[model samples]
Target chain A: MFDLQGYGPSLLAGASMTIAVGLSAMVMACILGLVGAWAKLSASYTARATAAVYTTVIRGTPELILLLLLYYGVPTLVQDLASLAGYEIILNFNPFLAGAVTLGLIYGAFATEVFRGAFEAIPRGQTEAAQALGMSRFRVAVHITLPQAMRIALPGLGNVWMILIKATALVSIIQLDEVMRKAKIAAGATHQPFTFYLLASFIFLGITLISSLVQRQLEKKAHRGVGQA
Target chain B: MNFTTMLEYLPQMLDGAWLSLQITGLSLFLGFLLAIPVSLMRLSHLAALRLPAQLYMFYFRGTPLLVQLFLIYYGSGQFRHELEQIGLWAFFRDAWFCAVFALTLNACAYTAEIFRGAILAVPKSDIQAGKAFGMSGLLLFRRIIFPKALRIALPSYGNEVIFLLQASSLVSIITLMDLTGVASRLVAKTFAVYEIYILTAAIYIAITYMLVVIFKLFERILNKHLRTDS
Candidate 1:
């Protein structure tokens, strides 16, 4: 039973940072997901193959490894290239940026699957109907395909967001003072590992519960007009 | 760039991989075994049994696995004196046991959910038919509920198993020299993070591919009876 006296503000700040990272990474993932899904569903073999490889490589590699590679490996590679070109490297890799990008890339793979499924779920007849009405393919996609695909994609996308939220704790390993890292520091200061860690767990559980409620609301709103099948 | 460097490190990586396999395999086997009972408890009428199982799943699944691993490994170390007094220190003293324990608990939480979902998805008609045939209790479950639920659960459980394999890499933090741990060590020594990490990623992808194949085969076998009956 560790008292929350000295550690409350620090943990709260960490929670805010975790949420910021999760949200930013999620936005990046969404952008990547849509593009990757579109590429995957493209008629061109090369586009599909490239998308498949991206998804496979991202999903197959562990997030920790990706974080390490991007944080440590990428910076070194960039510096080497800069040296080769006889220029100083200006952009250094920060841990937060590294973590966010890695998380975004990892979840983007999952998001692609969700988006692809959603895109495929749209009725083919609607596209045909739009085309018959003299709409261009681009117009059909804009007016018909994208909206329906988004609605269908909402639940799965929400699930990925939840996963990404939890996965942000791994960024603590890179010395980012997120919730888990702050908890570790507090535990060390107080010499109460169980109490601090349990408190951190409660914070995570709270995040999960609150986000789940939000996701449920979003799903409901997304499905407002769509009749239950 | 050369085969010789790879061959030289082969034995070390293989040893690391063996430990990983052992941890993943044993934990998965034990976790699945534990899941059956926990899932049953979840579906049980008794609140005493169901509440605990539900809470276990919620807490375990809600938190990140890394945090859970650190909490168990480092947090348990905080209780070393008490554990030593109780003669339980031997188990907690070994990093292998600690890793296995954390992984087993994590997998149990996930597998229980999968099993519970599959059990719920078992059609009412099947249970009714079993009842009509005079099957009851253990006999009914063994003959009807268990097998069908397993069939439904297999695909999701296979995915969970793959997740467990990947999750095992996190145990390297607790001083278990698994593949990722070895890779980290190699990177530290050789300063070639990219090559070592790429090698580790390749190994993981290869293992994941094999697991996918095995799972597909298992799913095929599970569906064999359903196919014939249909």
Candidate 2:
């Protein structure tokens, strides 16, 4: 029966920021994943090697290390580059931006695997037939490969989104005013840790449930005609 | 950039590495032990046992482990009087104990699911054979089902072990001087954030690489029939 009256507004505001951060990171992760998968699947040996190493290195390391390095080092990295270019300017890294980019970068590794599997799932014959029909490579990819890959990758991407949402909790360590951070602040101030945290947990649970529902609907839509077949 | 500063702090980083390994080792061991019973409960026909296991797994897997750590570490302070009444306040007071507690709970949830999946993967025909050979209940489980399940579970469980290693990094947030904690302290002292992180990441890569090698060899030996020359 612990009332959230006093701190409810801030918690909601924090949840909003959490969603924004999660979405922004999800977008970046999708972009990185697509590019990584493309490189890994491409004809160039160097491109494939670079993509393989990036995914391997990122997947093996913990996300916290990456977050801390980016948070504390990005500013220095910028300052150093600026000085080298003859401008000695001071720089500050935005916590939200840092959090999103880091999460995107980390999960990009997993997503590459997902997309790679999706790409592999598409039979080569489909592309061959498309090419036999005099379709351009762009047309073949867009019309035949991309849609089916999206259908197959959607479930995996949904899983990545789940992990991404949970990862937003880590950004609180960098002092981003996301839901976890706000809950921590309120818990410390009120000495009602369970109340705030439990509520925050429920909020996270609600988001997860909704996202799962959305994922289900998307899956149904993606498989509309194929499932009947 | 400052190699000397990093080299000077290498000892602290190593100390942190020891603590990290100890925590991950201890927690995953306890968690693995807990996982067996919890997963069995999840597989139970009785709603009473099954429901609790389901809810526990759902909550733990659904939420982030970091918040779980925060709740156990900081949340317990709010109930000191109750904990003191139960004579458990002393345990909750230590950050190390809280970190281990939270990590074990989170790991148990994941490992339990892995166990459950492996249990389901056990061929029913094999169990029927066990029963036909005059085995039943606990005897059947100990002789046949458990062994097969463990074998089936090994690869995924190896991934879980590596994940537990990664998750152990969060203990640094609870004020425990595990690897990440010590590295952060060094960063504060020397302002050599990038170098220290790169060095620490290298150690993690080394550990994870070693684990992958170990697991691959173990799996090969465990499932001799499944091995193929690549």
Candidate 3:
């Protein structure tokens, strides 16, 4: 009575949606993490303070709350801004978009710490060597600091990616039609909650398994030259 | 913009927050209890004990908690006669029991890993010293290994507590009137979804902030020996 043929398409669609959301959110988190690290490490006191507050507040709130708030609150916020600017505009919010942004913001706080630690691990001698080679400060950073820092940060970033993948499952609660939601619908329709749920968990396990393999490859590549030294 | 309106619904929200706190607390206690034995089993050299513990962690950690809750709460209904024969259908029928059971199982897996890591982290030198002092088994664990592992595990365990608190929001989906359930209900009744979500999120932020401060204090006291200036 378990009709995989009938539900196969929807379940696959859900898995792809989960991946799309997870990848988009990863890009957003990376951008936010970069900026957060910069602000935290900046010479300006206010920049440091602003980054501190951002990370602190984001860390203290649950991602579910953030997702719900953005999914519903974004349009209102846009409307208020438009009215204040003497224009009338309507904005439609998608749960996928809201979920990605919410997850991005929630995990960015953690990424900020990881990036900060990585950046701090970069030795002053390397930058000095880059400067001695007549490379400008910006060029040195682009050519030397970033590559090395990212290498150091790979393991931590991989851990975050795992967390992000699991966190994406929560998006289903907001009716995002991701894997978990897909599984729920199938369960309800077939009256086989255990079967559907177990299938969904297996799919997720497959994802995390493949992800761990890819992460191991990345870490090995990142550490290519270091083992000799 | 709807701050004043949200204020009008504050009492109900507060009650929901209290319920959330209770569920989180009770589940954490239950999970910690379950975690201790499972962690020991996981650390055991015996294959029989270790394989099942490994499977427990593998399934719980890999799956979504929402699905787990649904499977137990709704799926249990599918086996009403079987569960009734075992006298468990009565317990499984309640949303709170289902929520707590799912949360506790999930947390047990995570907390087991945390403790396993802490146990491994306990200095080998100290363990050897305990043996040298003529202590073994329970005496050694009680006098040395348990204390050190607990201290090592405290910070990560604190993060687990925060995670559990956040995860309890999922209970609302199962018909339990937690903070998120209240927010969702109010959103339905008044169509003030945005305002209610903001209020709910703010309450969570306050609770999380308090938890972090308390954990920091605990860490300070426990780690006094390592304090550079102390």
- On DockQ, the candidate that comes out on top is 2
Tens-place lDDT per residue, model 2, B1-230, is 56776787888888998999899989999999999999999999999999999999999988988889888988888889999999999999999999999999998999999999999999999999999999999999989999999999999999988888988999999999988999988888877778889888888878888899999999988998776865
Error of 2 at B60 (Å): 0.3
Q: Write the per-residue lDDT of candidate 3 for residues A1-229, one digit (tens) a residue.
A: 3556477788889999999999989888888998899899989999999999999878777777787778777787778779999999988778898889988988888888889999999999998999999999899989999999899988888888888888899899778999989988987888777777777887888888899999999988899988852
lDDT by residue for model 2 (A1-229), tens: 5777599999999999999999999999999999899999999999999999998888778899999888887787777778888997887789999999999999988899899999999999999999999999999989999899999999999999998999899999899999999999899888899889888888788889899999999999999989662
lDDT of 3 by residue, B104-192 (tens): 99999999999999999999999999999999999999899999999999999999999999999989989999999998899889877
Q: Best by TM-score, which number?
A: 2
Give the CAPRI rating of model 3: medium
Quote the chain B TM-score of every prediction: 0.95, 0.96, 0.98
lDDT of 1 by residue, B7-102 (tens): 567677778878889999999989989999999999999999999999999999999988888788778777889999999988887888888898
Candidate 3 structure lDDT: 0.88
* Candidates 1 and 3, the one with greater TM-score: 1
Model 3 CA deviation exceeding 4 Å by range: A1-5, A80-88, B228-230
> Where does candidate 2 stray beyond 4 Å?
A84-86, B228-230
Place model 2 in a CAPRI quality band.
medium
Task: Calculate candidate 1's fnat.
Answer: 0.48
Worst 10 residues of 2 chain A by lDDT: A73-82
Each prediction's DockQ against the real complex: 0.63, 0.72, 0.65
Q: Estimate each model's TM-score.
A: 0.95, 0.97, 0.95
